[model samples]
Target: MDCRRSRTNDPDQWIATCPEGSKAVCEELRDLIFRWEPDLKESVNSNMLCFSQKKRVCGISGFKNHAQLTFYRGSELPDPARLFNHGQENASIHSIDLPDGLEGLNLRALRSLLHAAVKVDTEPTQPKPPAAPREEWPMPEVLAAALKKNKAAAAFYEQLKPTYQREYKVWVGMAKQPDTIARRLEETVRALAAGKKWAQRKEG
Candidate 1:
C-alpha cells in the first residue's frame, strides 16, 4: 500500500486496504481495542488506525503477513504476559505481532494489556523531570578555519546551541581521509553560511 496516501477515518476503509491474509485479524483486533474501551477516539495517522484518549494510546496496522497492535506508551505499561514481540528497543512504542490465522492468540493477555493501556491514557499525567544537558563535542580545527574564512558562517555558528555546534564538529572530525575531511569541511561551511543546521544540510 502507498503509506504516504492519507486514509479515511472510517475503520472499515482502513481495514479494506490490509492484505487479504490479515484482514480478519485486523478486524478482530479493532473490535478488541474498542470493546476494551469504547470512548477512545479513533483516527487514521500515518496510514495506521490510531486510538487516543487525552493522548494517543495505541494503533493497529496490518502488514503483508501479520497484523500489529502497537501501544504508544508501551514501555510504561506492564506486560507480564510477554505479549509484546516488537519494538523492544524503542523508548515508548512497543507492539504485538498477530500472525495470520490467529491460531494461538491469547485473548486474555491481550485484553489485559488493552485495559492497562486505557487506564494509563485516562489518568492525569505527572510532570517530567528536566532533561540532562547534552555534552558538547570539541570543535575541529578544520571547521574553525573554514568558519574563520566565512564571516556569515561564523556568525551563524556562534548563535547555534552547543548541540547544533557539536553536530558539525562530530561530522568533520569523523572523516579520517584527507579528501573526505576537505569535502565535509566545504559542505559544513556552505550549510552554516546558508543558515542550515548539520541535519538540514543538503546532499550534493
Candidate 2:
C-alpha cells in the first residue's frame, strides 16, 4: 500500500492503508491507546497515528510485517517489563515492535507503559539548563604552515567564524598517522582556497 498516497485525519482511513500483515495489530494497538488514555488527542502526522496532550505522548506506525508503538519521551519512562525492542540508543524516542499479530502480547505490561507515558505528558517539564560552551580545538601546525604559504586560503580561513575554523582544525588534528595528517592538510588547504567550509568540501 502507498502509505503516502494522502494525508488522513480519520483513524479508520489511516489504518486501512497499513500493510496487510500489520493492519489488525495496528488497529488493536490504537484501540488500546484510546481505551487507556481517552483524553489524548489523536491525529495523523507524517503517516503515523500520533496521540498528544500537552505534547506528543505516543504514536503508532505500521510497517511491512509488524506494528510499532512509539513513546515520544520513552527514555524518561520505566520499562521494567522490557517490552521496548527498538530505539534504545535514541535520546528520547523509543518503540516496541508488535510482530506475530500480537500473539503472546503482555497486556498488563503494555498498559503500565501507556499509563506512564500519559503521566509524563501531563506533568510539567523543567526547562533544560544551558549547555556548556565547547572548548575550541587547537590549530594543527601542518594546517597553520599550509595556510601561511597560501595567501588566498589564509585570507579565507581568517574570515571564517570560529565554528567553521574549528571544523578544519578538528579534522586535521584528529589524524594520528603522519600520512593521514598530510592528506587531510592538503584537502583542507584546497577547500579553504575554494571558499568551502569543511562540511561543504567535495570528497575525492
Candidate 3:
C-alpha cells in the first residue's frame, strides 16, 4: 500500500490513508482507533498514520506482507503474557505484528493495550553499555551451543569478524544466572544467524 498521505476516515472517525493491499483493514483499524479515543488527534509521521494525546503516542503502518501498530511506549506495555518479542527486556522498542486480516484482535483488548502504551512514565530503559574496552575473547561454550543448535546463528558466527565474535561472548557473559545466560545466548545466536545486528531494535 502506498500510504503516502492522510484523509478523514469514516466509521472510526479517524483521518488515515489507504495503503494498497490492506486498505480495508486500514480503514477498519482507523475506525477502531477513533472508537477507542474519540478526541485524539490523527496525523501522519514516518509513513504511519499517527495518533496522539497532545503529542506523539502511536501510529499505524501498512506493508506488503503485514501491517503494524507502532506504539511509541510499547516497551512499557504490561504484556505479562509475553505477547511481544524481547519486549520489556530490551529498550523502549516494541511492536505487535498485524496479520493480513487482523482477524484475531479483540477490539476491547487492543484498546486496552493501546491505552496502556499511552500512559506516561519517566523511567529510562537500561542504558546501552558504553563501548567495550577493546579486548579479544574466546568463543564460549554458550556461543558454540548456539551455533550448533541454530543454523542462522551458526552462519552469522562464521561471517562475523573475530572482533564481533568477541563482542557476542562479552554480551552473553554479563547474564548473572546459568538459565538467564542460556536464554540470552540462544536469542543472540538466533538473532545473529538471521543477519540482525541489533535484534532489539524495531524493524519491519
Candidate 4:
C-alpha cells in the first residue's frame, strides 16, 4: 500500500488497497467486529485500523504476508481459546497474527476474544506510569568550540531542547571530510545566532 495516500479516517479504504494477501481476511474480521458492536468507531492510526468505543479496544494492521489484530489492553484479556500468539512480553498489548496460507479462521474463537477485549477496555483503568525524563546529548567538540566563540549562538544553543540540540550534534558529527565538518560547524553557529533550527534555513 502507498501509505502516503492512505485515508486516516477510513479503515475500509486501507483494507481495500493494502498489498497484503491476507487483507481480504482482515476485512472479514473487521466486518464481524462492526456487526457484533454497531456503535464502535473506526479510524486509521500509525498504519493500522483502530476500533474504539470509550477507549481503544483493538487495531488491525496489514503486512506484506499477514495481518494482525492487536488488542490495546490485551494483556488483561483472558484467552480460553488461547488465540493471542504474539506481543506477550509487552505490559499493555496483545496480538494475533494471520499468516499467509492459513485456510480459515475460527470465527467463534475470534468473537470470544473480541468480546473479552472490549470487556477489559470498559473496566476501570489504573494510574499510568510517569513519563520518562529526556536525556541530554553531549555537545560535540566542534559545535562546542563554535558556540564558545559566539556568545549569542551559545545562548541560543543552550536554550534549545535536548532533541533539537541532538539534531545539530548528529548533523555536524556525520560530516566525514575536515572541510565539510568545518563548513557545517560554521553554518550551525550562523543558524543558532539567527534563532533557526538545523535544516530550517532557506536554501539560496
Candidate 5:
C-alpha cells in the first residue's frame, strides 16, 4: 500500500508507505499480530502508526530503500545477536532493519516474538551512565548565567555533541525567560550546537 496517500480508519492513524517489499512485510506482520494478540490496540501517536498499551509496544514504518519495525522498549527485550543500532546505549528504542530479498518469508516467528515482547515489562530501565566528564562547552558567560536553572533545557544541552552546540545560544538567548529557556535549552542547544541528540543520550 502507498502509505503516503493512505489514512487509517481512525483519524489519528495514517498507514505509512515504504519500499514495495517492505509494505508486504509490514502487512504480514500486522496481520500476524492481530491473530496472536487480538486485543492489542492500534493507533498513531507522534504521527507514526503504533501498536501500544500504556505507553507504546511497537511502531511500524516504511523508509527509503528499506523499512523498520521499531520496538520502543527494545533495550529491555532479549537481543542475543545485538543487531540493533540505536546510536546510544541503555535506551529502549531499537529497530529490526528489513533489507530486500528476504521478502515473503513466513513472518510468523517475527510476529510471535513481538507479541511476546509486548508482554515483557520495559520499566526499571537504568539511567544512561555519564559520559566521561569533559570540560563544559565554552558557552558564553552571559549565556551561562542565563541558563543555570532550567532542567529540560540543561538536559538538552548536555546531550548535544560538539558540532550542534551553537543553535541553542541563538534560540534561547532570544527568549524573554532567557535563563529558564537556557536551563531548559540544554537539550536543544546540545542538539543544535553539538550535532547530537538528547533522547539518544541515556537520560540519567
Candidate 6:
C-alpha cells in the first residue's frame, strides 16, 4: 500500500485503483457510507477513503485479501451483532474486514453502526491533547553498535532528514527473516558510512 498521503481528494479514483474483486466491494461500501449520510465529507487520507463530519468518522481501504471499514472511534461504540473482528483491544479504533467473495454485508446492521459513529462525532467532547513531537526511529542494538564504531557514519546518519532516516528504519524493520535483517543491517551500515541514502544503494 502507498504510505505517502495522496494529493488527490477524489474518492472514486482511490476506489477504482483497487484490485478486481476489491474494487466492487470498495465502491459498494463507499456508496453506502455516502447514502447513509449525505453531509459526510469524503477525502483520501493515507491511501484510503476517509469520511469526516467535523472530524474523521471512518475510513475504507482495499488490500489484496480484504477491504476494511475502520471506525475511527469504534472502541466506544456498541457492537451487539459483533461485526467488528479487529482492533478490539485498541483504545480508539475498531474495524470490520470484508474478505473478497464473502456474502453480502448486513446492511441493516452496518447502517446502525454508521449512525452510532456519526452520533459520536456530533456530540460535544473534551478537546484532545496536543500531539507530541515525532521521535526518531528506535535503532536496533546491532545497528547502534555499528554506528558507534564508525563516527563518520554516526554523524552522517544524525544529519539525515527524518524522512530519510525513517526510510532506512522501515527497510530494516520490515525484514521478517533473521538472515534478511542481518543482511539489511550490514548494508545499511555500509551505506551510511559512504554517506548514501538507502535507495541509492545498488539492488542486491
**What's the TM-score of each model vs. the native?**
0.59, 0.62, 0.50, 0.56, 0.48, 0.57
**TM-score of the candidate numbered 3?**
0.50
On residues 1-204, what C-alpha lDDT tens digit does candidate 2 reach at each position?
124634577877989978898889989988988898899998887778989999999888888888888898888889998988988777678988887767887889989999999898878764544678998799888889999999999999999999999999999999999899989999999999999999988854
Residues 134-188 of candidate 3 have per-residue lDDT tens digits of 6666667767776787887778677877766666777887777999997877678
Instruction: Tell me the tens digit of each residue's lDDT in model 5 across 88-138.
Output: 354567767666523653465566557656776344545655678655445
The segments of candidate 1 whose C-alpha lies over 4 angstroms from its true place after superposition are 1-3, 124-204
Best prediction by lDDT:
2
Model 2: lDDT equals 0.86
Models sorted by lDDT, best on top: 2, 1, 6, 4, 3, 5
- Tens digit of per-residue lDDT, candidate 4, span 1-204: 213434555776888876567777678768888998777889888777889988989988777788788888887877877787888877788888878423566678888888887777778764556678766656688888888889998898889987888899988888889999999888888888988888784443
Show the lowest summed lDDT stretch of 10 residues, model 2. Answer: 1-10
Q: Model 4, residue 192: displacement in angstroms?
A: 45
Task: Indicate which candidate wins on TM-score.
Answer: 2
Would you list the clashing residue pairs of candidate 2?
Answer: none
Model 3 Cα shift for residue 48 (angstroms) = 0.8
- How far residue 177's Cα lies from its native spot in candidate 2, in Å, is 5.5
- Of candidate 4, the 10-residue stretch with the lowest lDDT total is 1-10
Writing each residue's lDDT as its tens digit, candidate 1 over 139-175 gives 8888888898999999999999988888899999999
Measured on C-alpha atoms, candidate 5 has an lDDT of 0.57
Q: What C-alpha lDDT values do all the predictions have?
A: 0.84, 0.86, 0.65, 0.79, 0.57, 0.82
Better of 1 and 2 by TM-score: 2
